[model samples]
Target: MVTAAADPTPQTADAQPWGRVDDDGTVSVREGDDWRVVGQFPDGPPEEALAYYERKYSDLASEVTLLEVRHRRGGASAADLRSAAKAVSAKINGASAVGDLASLDARVAALTETLSAETETEAAAAREAVDEAVKVRTELVEKAEALAARDPRTVQWKQASAELSTLFNEWQSQQQNGPRLPKSTAQQLWKRFRDARATVDKHRREFYAELDEAHKEVRDRKTRLVEKAEALAPKGEEGIAAYRELLDQWKTAGRAGKKADDALWARFKAAGDALYGARSERETADAEASREKIAAKRELLEEAKAVPDERDLAKARALLTGIQRRWDEVGRIFPREAERGLDDDLRKIEQSLRTREDADWKRNDPEQKARANDMTRQLTEAIEKLEDELAAAEKSGDKASIAKASEALEARRGWLRALGG
Candidate 1:
């Protein structure tokens, strides 16, 4: 038969209550009106352990389960709860359980390891993205630099440069946050930059090629003009015509190199000057022949002036008429003192004949003397008008008016001299 155990002291309402304990050895003690769990523990339980705690104390299984769910959702996992429970139990026991502590420590360590791995994976992905962005940015920058070096004035270059600059800036910002690029991206960027550079170079080469061709055309035209000018240097009148043609060609020809232009001009000028000098010498010889003719005309003038004043007026008149005819036959005199000398001598002879005619008219009848007086009055009026005209002409320095007034005065003097006779 079984022996009955001694009865324990009965618990009263005033006595300190036994606190609830979870399956994982987490205890919940009553503090005033509320229940406070001593430590957190895993939610899954040994069913008997949980039932014992519910029976010993007021039922709190539902509240404990709710707390466990809240903790789990808030990043505190079953392993965290278990680790906390072991720490609390060790403290309460006042005896170090190295093995229990080690098991709890191992669970925490494994969780930490998993978190670190996940962080490393995310970091690596971020680094890769950054690297790709950096590669793109570097390519954009190089392309922009090359385009800028080309003609900045062109619309294409300017637009391309601006776009590249903006893209590069964005790419650099991305690179700062991301990882380095692989070899493929780097090569692609370099190729784009090189293509831009090559395009610019091609444009420059074409520009220079056109310029060189234009210069060559100018040089050819100038060379041909120089040869033509040299060829016509020997011909006198013909050379002048050729020289004009050369000048026209020179104007039509586009500009040559500086040295070539100067050399060609000098050669052409020298050839033309030689031809002109020869023509000038021939002109001088013709001028000498003209001078001789003027001298002969002047001698004729002096001979006519030396005609004697005789009673035989008819003979003298006939001689003067013959001299006048001879004067007409002579050619143009030299434009010098010889021409003036001829004019003076001829004027003297004409004045003497006019005086003789006036004397003859005065010696005639009373009707003739009346006519002479009337003519003299008219002459005096004409002289007075001429004097006024001469004064105006002198004031104005009008050579043509002065000459015309002088001729009128001389004609009036002839009329006045007839009156004296």
Candidate 2:
């Protein structure tokens, strides 16, 4: 509030220097250096007229003060405050108000300048936000396009689908929370993201559809295989061979899905287990029947090791021959792997005997002995001739011929030594 005394010696804004009440009841507001008649107030006294216009000045001052406070507090936008300030300034200019109108205009102009800089700062921040938003959206678009470009045949559809969904969710979140992007950039990115998402979805659907068809084919084949195996159940133990053939076919059959394959395999395996169970019962009987033979063969095998230990080749052969005769008498055993194992053990003993016989034959055979004796005779004759030549060279004092003859004679002696002659 402002008050003025009728004295005109000195004034301030509070002293109401800008307002005066005329003796004729006219109210006036001051511009910089001059005063303008605002209105006539004949119904009031000088003080009342001045007070009336001063109240108007107070309202305008409050508006300016409010603008200043709002600018400091920073909830309202700077541009909005600047607009309000312009309106306030218009009201204060040439207003029928009087307490320091010039000062209010100065405050409004100063506030407008501050607001202009604040508005620029806000615009720069918005641009930065928009740029950041574009960068984020571009990354999302690139990632989606990368996913879309994968080979559908090789893609792990479940994981890829989940990843695509997550990327889409991220895109939506950014769209909702991030700053607005340029229309062109936003539309382009969305088109790329949408196209890529649609492509991934299309590929996923087609890939799964093909996989389901393939699974159906495999399922039908495996179902028929199960039926075939089940049909073999009536053959009991005799059906094992046929069941083995069906197993081979089953291995060639492509996979159905895990759940379906597991269910189908249970049926197939149950059928196989039935056939094998019958086989197991027959094997148990055979094993019982062959227990005696297995024991007998085992005993013979323990004794057969002596065949290799025998120093006399003839005795070793005789012992192995007797063991083989006893082995034949014991006859076949059960569970072919066990029979094969036993046969292999015994065959190893036989092979040992054969190897010993071969070595002994090479040592004492008449033909080989005769050939060795012939080679010895040839070497002896050659050695004797070389000795005579060496003696002649040495006696004649021919150093070159002596060395040649001595070297040949020494080589022949070494051959004789190697032959143990």
Candidate 3:
């Protein structure tokens, strides 16, 4: 059988690594079966030509080595490595330079196979991350929905509004930095959040509007009260009790906003202060007028003080009665405390004089004297009868009857002496 001719470029003692220069000034690279002409380098020496082609082959080998290193170090993405491996494999096939080209192809193929599994794992991880992001976003949406569901009247609007703002900011931060969610899922969460915000805003606005209405009503009521209170200033002290009633109404009237309430209260309080000022001035004037009355009453009390120590009860009674009549004519004293003190002192003297008169009446009563005289006669007769019984007992020699009669006669005599008979 005829075989292919052996390479005409003989193998020398110093052989090149990948390419050899032929006599025709052409460079040939070795394949598995034969040598193929790659290019000519006419101006260069044979060794230089061989070296040039060998450098090209070294470059290809270096690229494949770098890819292998990057794959082992895991510095580049598996997809990017797969692409690079394909590019390098194409360059190695029928390449202009050579250094174990088949082995480089085998290495690239191995790298491609390894990257397949890695790409699948990376894709799965990315999907999982997106799912977690969606879950977090859904939780935020649920919180907003709950806040919107609260009754408007019961909600503390300031705190609730702040919480909603915080949640919205968190959503924005997550959207900007976190894993991107699927389009449909992101839209759904955003829609729910938007609707909840709308509901909260609507409720807040309505609540404030109603509050303003109520405040207006309170302002109207307080304004009327302020006008009435100011009108009472002309009544002076006489209007105090009536003004007190308006003040009570003012207390029950709710808030009318800070500025209006403060202004209205200033006017109302000024009216009340005016009334009190009038009352205070009147009291001071009355107190000055009462000094003379208090002096007159003191003089009367000194005169009445002698009644309690008088020797004649009848004369003391007459003098006290006259003093009391004059005291009434003195009229009432101002500052009730001074009047009470003077009246109490006079009352004590009057009570003493009356007690003495009562004792004198009891002592000289005719009816009491008559009753005493009658009792004296009855005791004198009983004494005589008991004395006779004593004598009979002594004669009869009955000592028990004698003792009993003597005791009864003594008791009767003692009663007659007590009656002043």
Backbone atom clashes (below 3 Å) for every candidate: 5, 0, 0
Best by TM-score: 2
Error of 2 at 21 (Å): 5.9
Compared with the true structure, the alpha-carbon lDDT of candidate 1 equals: 0.61
Order the candidates by lDDT, highest first — what do you get?
2, 3, 1
Residue 2, candidate 1: how far off, in angstroms? 88
Q: Which ranges in model 2 have alpha carbons more than 4 Å from their true place?
A: 1-30, 34-77, 94-98, 117-160, 163-167, 178-214, 280-291, 308-312, 334-345, 388-411, 418-420
How good is model 2 by TM-score? Answer: 0.72
Error of 3 at 20 (Å): 3.7
lDDT tens string, model 2, 246-352? 99999999999999999999999999999999989999999999988889999999999999899998888888899889999988899788899999999998888
For residues 135-247, what per-residue lDDT tens digits would candidate 1 score against the true structure? 56675667555664666445364456456556656655655655556678756765665566566656656655775788788888888888888888668755887788788
Candidate 1 wrong stretches, greater than 4 Å: 1-209, 298-421
lDDT of each: 0.61, 0.88, 0.84
Better of 1 and 2 by lDDT: 2
2 or 3, greater by TM-score: 2
TM-score versus the correct structure, for each prediction: 0.30, 0.72, 0.56
